[model samples]
Target: MFTDGRLLSDPGPILARVRHRGSPRAFVFAGVQRVPVVSEEVGQALKTLAPGDVQLFPVSVEDVDERFFIVNVVRVVDCIDEAGSTGVQHYAEDDPFPERAGEFRWISGLRILPEKTEGARAFMLKRFKHPIIVAEEVKEALERIGNLGVMFKRVTGNPGA
Candidate 1:
């Protein structure tokens, strides 16, 4: 949902205010094709994409119709502070190098279209901190999926929406 001019800034506050829960472990969104990774992985990947590029982060779930899901693309800025390092160590018990400083902060989280909702594209643009740019490859992938008529439906009452 990032617009055309707001790249290279932080999208943290907007993400924190979102009411949705993080994606559940069992309902990984990998099959969506348009969205290729888990939220954490997506955050990591954003580090390489050009700032302001729009990218969709798909979340998959069962018991919902196939036409609704969340989709949004906004600029991501990673801040790897000491607290982030602590979080990583806590999550990954077998820290590869516990003695060394852990200096890796991920995309943290991002904003996307809520499930069963429309206007996400516009919403992200308006709320995002920076101008959004859609990566050429990502845009092409979306187009390919659109041509195939692959759509998603939102699931109400789902814990991880």
Candidate 2:
């Protein structure tokens, strides 16, 4: 794992589709840049973001074997805690959603269905698809994160050897 964010827990199975609905007001301000979180702690921290809370985390990926990697977790307290915290929009101190903070369990699944990220640009994914097919650079990036050499060798089969 890259040493900065202190995210990325031990590899685990993750659901393929996740739902992290973006706030409409944020869309109005920042377009489509949603900071991806990997670990539950980071997800908890990120939940405390309003609009201007510019934090970063690693992008999640679906590896070649159908296992999910780098899932971001979310909860209600963090969202409620973030109110009026100088984000894309300002919420009054009344913070209309305090009641929502206890309504559900923490949600941590997979990709936000149809969300995009900077790392996703390194590969190709069509809508209605299940697997994330890798491009050249993306394959290299995967190698950096962990060994996928078995998959690579199975594909290449000593093409140059």
Candidate 3:
């Protein structure tokens, strides 16, 4: 996994390549830019972050199928154990939800639905929250997989293929 601030700046190029192939489907951000924190541990792996870093993890569509349809895993770091320590907390301390740490709070999976498959589509649509920044690279990878399926069907002389 490539880790650095440059990943965020031009994720477009990396994403584009991923879209073309059905490999390296996952992408993760190691820091949350514009956030602040007291120690550097939070920003070590990530770049251009605020106070802390945010990581990204990406999974390929093909891998999901091979693994029983599990797509992605997202882990957010935003918890502090304040054992009665009266330390000065920054203004941005309240920005991240401390209640949830080491938890997969974001999108975790994506499944392919057959065309016109209302039941399947409905389920995915509900699971995927709106306003999601579905990167172009991800979209491209999925599209490539779709095209492969179509090709297989035509060649095998079976729509199910």
Candidate 4:
């Protein structure tokens, strides 16, 4: 979060570290998916949210892998901006171009730190070579999901605790 306490989860920088920081490093996929689009059942299963708000479906990444962390995906917005390009997708099926693919959803997730650990401190101190842009709605949803994670941590001693 910024100093004003707006939550954020910018995957780009952390991912860059995984790729460029470690020695003897092998490239790993962040495991993007969109096999089943959000249906009525899925929407209802998640909460009282409307089906239309759920542009991305639930992905199962529920294990402690050496290289992966289970990040909560809160929202996926249609990138109509990237319309005319070729649809070489990572999350969606063969559909990178929104014009041809119907809608391209960019993944945004929840992030938090209890009190800036060593890793968090290192991450914050790192310099960024490029601008990592995420959508506004996606950021808001991530903040909401992050608040839920914080609540869960307090109650159940789960995530972020």
Candidate 5:
């Protein structure tokens, strides 16, 4: 639902079933698709840091009564500095999905115009919702939680470095 950047009317009961038994972290991608899921602690931090940038929906994980929420980052900023970025590829006209010709196929070492973000703390890059971009404050908050299953990459400074 979040991939489209639209507000959900009623997401219904979201269930994240556990496929493997292990200790869960404060944050973790739901599956191979990398859907962002957060524990109550992490969710509270996000709620405080970016109350307007995200919508948290309660989720039920298989066999675990612990509270969790599926993080739906609603903001999609079109601020990618394409020229300053490297290893960026857009779908070409000859590609199978011709409609996506101008859309990002993949991006490595991504860079964005911080000013163009319009002060959004947590957001997804327009046309490339796979990666979530969070401000330093948010990162710090997540780090403070300590048990993160996510990794961070700097996206706004020293492009091409």
Candidate 6:
């Protein structure tokens, strides 16, 4: 999510629009600006499962009666094991956003220092917010709910030599 807590502070009404409607509905999907929109069930589960790691704000989706929420995964941790990762790149000095020159632009074969996660079940990388990292337990819990529009990549297990 791109929100930096400003969304939490803003007291304005929140509205959303679904571009399509079909079966196998996604319980968690990208809303406007890539913000996470989740079903009330998913939202409540997250609130109980990772209360300290996320914040949920109610949202009104066009023509839908079921409650939905915008999930803001609040915790940001600098735990990327850069030395252990592969295909990693940073924003270039000549890029448009020079201030982000040294920040992560892309990362494959992601690895993280488990010890540095601060016991958070869900968190985003300090400089990279594209993926929301969740602990194994959290992953299992979400999986149990089904209809998730996301996938998991193992970044904490042993690397085969």
Per-residue lDDT tens digits of candidate 6, residues 32-72?
A: 55777888888888888788888888888888888888888
Order of candidate numbers by TM-score, starting with the best: 5, 6, 1, 2, 4, 3
- Which scores better on lDDT, 2 or 4? 2
lDDT string for model 5 (70-161, tens) is 88888889999998788898999999999888899999878999999989999988877678999999999899989899999889779545
The 0-to-1 C-alpha lDDT of every candidate, in the order given, reads 0.32, 0.27, 0.24, 0.26, 0.87, 0.79
Tens-place lDDT per residue, model 1, 1-161, is 22222333333432211124443331123332333222433333343443334444333344432322233444343311323222232223356645433433222222232332232222122322222323444434444433222333221233246
Instruction: At residue 129, give the lDDT of candidate 6.
Output: 72
lDDT of 2 by residue, 1-161 (tens): 22122234444433323343432111111113322323333223333332122223333333322222232221111112222212223223455755334332222121222123322312212221112223345345445544221243211122234
RMSD of 1: 16.4
Query: Residue 22 in model 6: shift from native, Å?
Result: 1.9
The full ranking of all candidates by lDDT, starting with the best, is 5, 6, 1, 2, 4, 3
lDDT by residue (tens digit), candidate 3, 1-161: 22112124322221111134443322212123211111122122222222122333222233233211111112221221223212313323244865433322332222222332232101112222211122233334434434222111111112243
The list of candidate 4 runs beyond 4 A from truth reads 1-29, 32-47, 53-59, 62-141, 147-161
Per-residue error for 27 in candidate 2, Å, reads: 30
Sliding window of 10 residues with minimal summed lDDT for model 5: 1-10
* lDDT: worst 10-residue window of model 4: 121-130
**What does candidate 6 score in Cα RMSD to the true structure?**
2.3
Better candidate number, 2 or 3, judged by TM-score: 2
lDDT of 4 by residue, 45-70 (tens): 33333222222223322232233222
Best by lDDT: 5
